[model samples]
Target: MRQLNKFTFNICPTVSIHNQINLLSNEDIKYTFNDFQKNKQIISCVDNFSEIERDECHIYFCPYESKEYHKITNNFPGGIFIHVHEIALFDEQPFEHKSFFQISQSFRFMKKLTLINDKRSRKLHDNNEHLSIIKYPHLSQLDLSEAQDDYIEQFLVDTKTCLPNSFYLCCRLSSTEKSDTTLCKKYNMNKLFKSAFVMFNCIFQGLSLFDRRFNQLRVLHVNSSWIRYSSRLTINNTENLPNLKCFSLYCDTDTVVYDELIVPLLHRMLDLEKLHLYLIIGYKNTFIDGNNLKRNIINHMPPLNIFTFNIRTTVHLHNLN
Candidate 1:
């Protein structure tokens, strides 16, 4: 005689497939929703998925389905993992499903989740209220530079866990914004841009809006465009970051004001230990040269007995590629 043990459970989707064979009989297997008129148990199965033990299930689906599973598993030990590609399939459900309130309730338990794709569903997941429950001490790594700024910013805001000690971010501003480039009349493009100075000021303002989550940041990197926008003006409250120790900035062009903006900001970062900068082009031939840039910044930034400052300038090359 074979004895079945109740505690030995298979919670993986692959294992669930095998269970489906036993749980659903030949008659029930034949009744797909498309042919449900012939048999009603399939609909009963879909509607009453809760009848299964909370600890005996695992679901694999896109963000929306993952969100639904989160709602169902809040009391269960394991959480759901999102698959970015299949989200649209769940989203394409007949109009009735879109209006279903049960789906919304199902998403309310979504927390401590890992987003798997660059899709908008990932963005929506970041905004979910349950995100703050994410346990930071257990987090191994996170890569957010490729994510949209709105998602990236909100994720940091919702992050209750200290950021991992090491990570990589490759952030670049969108090049097509009329405000960053030129004015145009055909698309009312000039109005589209809020003006470079205003956009620049907003970068400085964002630091204030940056929530206390920044206290966990130990190392920070910024591309030239981020500097162009965020460095256009210096922020005043940087002293709030108690753990910050290293900073790096890449500049598109050698601009003296970059130093001006950075010096004052660094003055507030007392724990700063190392600073590095890469410039695409050396300072525009003018009164300020590398020597002046070094002297002026050293006078205002946080004191450093041992640190490395290196600058690389690039020039237009002929067809090496």
Candidate 2:
């Protein structure tokens, strides 16, 4: 490790980005790179990061308190691209949307980013569900393990930030030592590829944790009511488990219809050839008729071969003579 000479600089709080996909207004890249100072702590730069211990290769901007402590400026530059791989942002100040934009401007290829702020986020002006979303195109792991309440809204809120496609963010206690799978997926992480998921004993909060589709999954059996997110899968842009061939869900009693929860879930199984549903359904506005199966569910799953379901629906006849 070569001696890292500390260079000081200053950076604007908010940077304007034009090409940031799914983000704010398009106006060419208006970000500027100013020179580093001799004796200041506004912005800091040290470019000796290389896999093989080289010089002036990877630039890492990590801002802290002064809203300038972490900005990675390129003074001794080989090229414009700053290859910051791992970053740990520690600050006492509350992080706002601008804080992310500043990071996103330079760390386009950052793999692992850790945020260490306990304070909440201050909402930006005109913040809404339809606002431009800040996207991290190549970021694979974001360790919000030390973030807090306002961080959830700043990161998880659909309108604020956009992670990679099929990205699933899970939050467990940082102290807990268990790895739980997403709602739609549960595979052994140690084993890269898994074919079947069969659990007829324990009931999980069905579809509540399902975020991404399982393409390699062929069989899934669960003892679950399977009613949550029945109306939200499509809206959330959840793709189908395309390769699933067999699915069996058994529920003791549920008040959901085939249209709402059951069929919407089945529609995701594009390649499913066999299905078995044991459901005791009651008190729904609509009953599961043959057409409901044929048009709503079956029509979507083109390769469906054997369709079997035991459903009982109780309907109330009103104003009968």
Among these predictions, the greatest TM-score belongs to: 1
Residues 202-225 of candidate 2: C-alpha lDDT, one tens digit per residue = 233344333343455566555553
RMSD of each: 13.5, 17.2
Q: Over the full model, what C-alpha lDDT does candidate 2 score relative to the true structure? A: 0.50
lDDT of each: 0.36, 0.50
Residue pairs in clash, model 1: none
Q: Where does the lowest 10-residue lDDT sum fall in candidate 2?
A: 171-180
Per residue, candidate 1 scores C-alpha lDDT tens digits across 51-167 of 232213232222222222322221222223342111111221121211222322323232222322233433343444443343333233333333333333333433432333433
Q: What TM-score fits each model? A: 0.40, 0.37
TM for candidate 2 is 0.37
Q: Deviation in angstroms for 26 in model 1?
A: 19
Give each model's clash number: 0, 6
Best by lDDT: 2
User: Model 1 off-target regions past 4 Å?
Assistant: 1-116, 122-137, 158-216, 229-242, 253-256, 281-290, 299-306, 312-321
- Which residue pairs in candidate 2 have backbone atoms (N, alpha carbon, C) closer than 3 angstroms, thus clashing? 61-72, 62-70, 63-70, 183-209, 183-210, 184-210
